[model samples]
Target: MLRDEIITVFGGSGFVGRHVVRALAKAGYRVRVATRRPHLAQDLRVMGVVGQVQLVQANLRVPASVERALEGATGVVNLVGVLNESGRQTFSRLHALGAKTIAESAAAMGIRRMVQVSAIGASATSLSRYARSKAEGEASVLAALPEATILRPSIVFGTEDSFFNRFAAMARFVPALPLFGGGKSRFQPVFAGDVGKAVLAAFERDDARGQTYELGGPGVYTYEALMRLILEAIDRKRLLLPLPWAIGKVIATVSELVGALPLMPVIITRDQLIQLQSDNVVADDAKTLADLGIHGETVEAIVPSYLERYRHHGQFHEREA
Candidate 1:
């Protein structure tokens, strides 16, 4: 393969990054998966022929490391993001400054086609720090590379997604699943694969350059409806309790503390709760799945396939005697 045909994917070991890498590989593009720990992405080797996908260590906080990751690449895709800020990985540094560095590096290397994975609610004035950082990242990427295509997906879902898995696990322990803001918040839950394919498609199409696409699934669901669907998929009849925003924030604060432990926590954070206050769905006027010549997948069709494990008796539970 030509050197310029290689694509460097930052955060390729992450939930969305893995799918993007697989999609790029299938498109006959050599992939360089950049992450802090490259060993964790060894499984990606199966996505393509030997030597087609290479793994390398890259930390967004370090410009030299980021440059090394982007070295010898024709294009780049940034999938690094965080729901909560942590020590040395603040939203400003990782999403904003880090994004600027990557875009500049790619431009300096003569890589014009870049895809930046941002979130749906990205805005400079957004209340959620996550959203603000994402917006900043978009601005920085676009300014650095005017031809960059930025994709903002709304609450991407997949078999290994943290959202559905977290709720399914909760149904196993809690009698009721808490729904923030009366469960009225809506979401468009696009599949991770669809987004990945779209990224690769966009990378190949010059028409997509300088455009911002809002990717979402075919159907939209309220928070309560989503929870119910998850419960039904898991074969659990847990109550969907709606909590006020104030109370939810308090609970989330406590949960953040618990999450600091060596093990994962059972709950989320106040910032996450604040994020829930805003709906996560594609805008009507924005470019969508149909525009990319790809039809969106329904949650009903995909959720049950993986969520069956959370059912009372697993797959066998629904079998007729």
Candidate 2:
């Protein structure tokens, strides 16, 4: 297998990181899963042959830890990101400075293939601090590793994703789902597996180096439509309430405060509200999965399979008499 060469994956224990790690392992690449808690990543071992995957504790906030993770690695991928600021893990610190630290270390090691996972709305001038920090991360990465491949994906959906799972759970409890912005916010949700495959494809081509790709699913869905799908899949009915920006901001502010408690409400944050105001689809001009010769999945075709568990009678109940 070609993967005998070491490929270090930063944040490999995370949601997207797990998928990427499996994909890389399947491609026959030796993988090093780097995260703050290496013990939690023991599950990653089953993805590859015994000893093919190693988990190392690496914190990007500390340059020494990040540099140590990069040692003797031919390739590196950065998948570290956060939705909200928790204590010292601020947006600037984690997204911007953390990315710089990792990329700089990779470049210093002369690693040629570096993949960075970012979001579609990452812009230095964006309204949300999350988006702005993402843009800063991109810039810092490019500054250090000019040939790094950056992938900015739309809302990623999978069985374990927060997007659909949150709404599905909300349908179970709340009679009405409060949308951040009038339920008109648009998104093209890409499958996480597709994004992982794209990362590997990008790693194979030097042409992909120094370039950015935007990945999206085949269908573009409004927030209201998305909620309706979740309800239908979960076999629960609910009202889709459009939250005006002003009301949403206030609610988000309160939610942020409440989430500070020992047990968080899992509520959306102010930055997330700001993000919903903007479109999250891939730009027409950008290279997408299709450009990479990959056909993308639609939410309609894929989501129901996993969501069946939430149905009234479960999978067996769906059997026709």
lDDT of 2 at 268: 88
Q: What's every prediction's RMSD, in angstroms?
A: 1.7, 1.7
lDDT of 2 by residue, 127-216 (tens): 899999999999999999888989999999888888888777667767799976689989999998888888888888767889999999
lDDT for 271 in candidate 1 is 72
Task: Please give the lDDT score for candidate 1.
Answer: 0.88
Instruction: List where candidate 2 sits over 4 angstroms from the true fold.
Output: 313-321
Per-residue lDDT of model 1, residues 1-321, tens digit only: 423388999988888988999899988899999999988789988888889999999988788998898888889999988767777878898889889999998898888889999989999999888889999999999998999999999888898998888899889989999988899999999999999988987887777989999999989999999999998788878888989999898999888888888777647887778789988999979987677777988899898789888887888887434
As a TM-score, model 2 comes out at 0.96
User: In order, how many clashes per candidate?
Assistant: 0, 3
Q: Which residue pairs collide, candidate 1?
A: none
Q: Model 2 clash pairs?
A: 3-28, 3-29, 3-30
TM-score of each: 0.96, 0.96
Return model 1's CA RMSD, one decimal.
1.7
